[model samples]
Target: MFEELSQYLGWTNCFPEGESFLVIAEGTDCGFILQHFIHTFLKRKLPVCLVSTSQTFSHYSQAGIKIGANLDKAREEKSIHLVDLMSKFLNHYTGQIECDWNAKNIYLSIKEELDSMEISANSILIVDDISVLSSLCLSIDDIGNLLHYLHALSKQRGFNILMSIPSLDCEQVQDTQSIAEHYADTVLCVKSLQTGYSKEVHGQIEVVKGGRSNCGVRQYKLSDKNLHLFARGTSMAVL
Candidate 1:
């Protein structure tokens, strides 16, 4: 999983069962971080559902192979499910469920799918970059409704809800952003380090609030299979 980084933001301390987390990453590397995160749970054979609006299922499949995850086995065992919301852009639909921006129906669809499959304590629902909510022309009210629905589902099923929402300042973005921050059990803010000097460090994160509030900032590097951590002045060789 996160290895040494787990002492900070990994599930070992960050995302416990039946909790909710909001991971805010301003950098593009959020996707890589998320891939490894998903791979970690799959490695543990936890039931996982990924609602993707950013990438196609094939992209995730390739990432699984890159990370050495038994994705095929996980799929066969019904341990992992990917819900693709972007495939329709290519005039195709292929996912555990084809999701839309409608709040109520989305929740019902997700609940129905999870119900039809095996779910357990270690189960988790990951919504890749909730920024898509606003990007898809959803209003603040719409986003709020969606968040509440997902939060309820998490509580009802005893699984965690993990979402990545970028920090934006527009009125509409601001409207729903606060809901995510306030609604989460933990918040992991991911952003690039403002190093006075350049280095290999990928980003910095902090548990600004929530269940694990006061967690300090830490820098990390991302490989296809791992998240490597380093302190200031520590050489990559130390990793």
Candidate 2:
């Protein structure tokens, strides 16, 4: 969907099948990037299972419409399956008056949902952001294990995995973060500018492909319509 980003990542038309993508947002929300992936897959007529721990299906639907992807239509056609963890969490705390922070339950829920859906090599499973799991009092090891299980499940089901997580400490790489990176075929690290905020540039993104020597870094700015990526040192105001 984004030509500059597609070219930077060496994707001609669509993302590679059955590959894992780890998006680590250092100091900002990377939901836009995740939405981009959803848009891409929907454009290709591929199925998507969105495991959202942070946002609702309605939120994605509205955002997808803004980006030219009709998530509601996709959902109606059974091309998009949503697992709303946020709603489940809310219900658990309010209705049931209980807390279940077990990562295994999360894993089982994902597996069950995927099993009930139509999956292929080109299908994708997207986890909006995993920071909520940490807030739910799940340990780092639990989160890591959940990701590992999801990765394995994706591999077995011949589908791609797109997972987003926040980095608590930018300088200190936690074991959970390392585990996510280790299992990913590609990693997109979104970090705020060390020089501080700018009106033209929102942040920087580094694309790392496993076993690849060449990685690309780009400064990006977000718009209501789309994301604009510029080469490092290039400012959007100059464009």
Per-residue accuracy of model 1 over 60-143 as CA lDDT, tens digit each? 778778767766677777788866656542343344454454777666767777787677877888888777767666677878
**Clashing pairs counted in every model:** 0, 0
lDDT of 2 by residue, 41-74 (tens): 8898988999988889999999888778889989
Best candidate according to lDDT:
2
lDDT of candidates 1 onward, in order: 0.71, 0.83
- Model 2: pairs clashing at backbone N, Cα or C within 3 Å: none
- TM-scores of all predicted structures: 0.83, 0.90
> Deviation in angstroms for 203 in model 2?
1.2
Global fold similarity of model 1 (TM-score)? 0.83
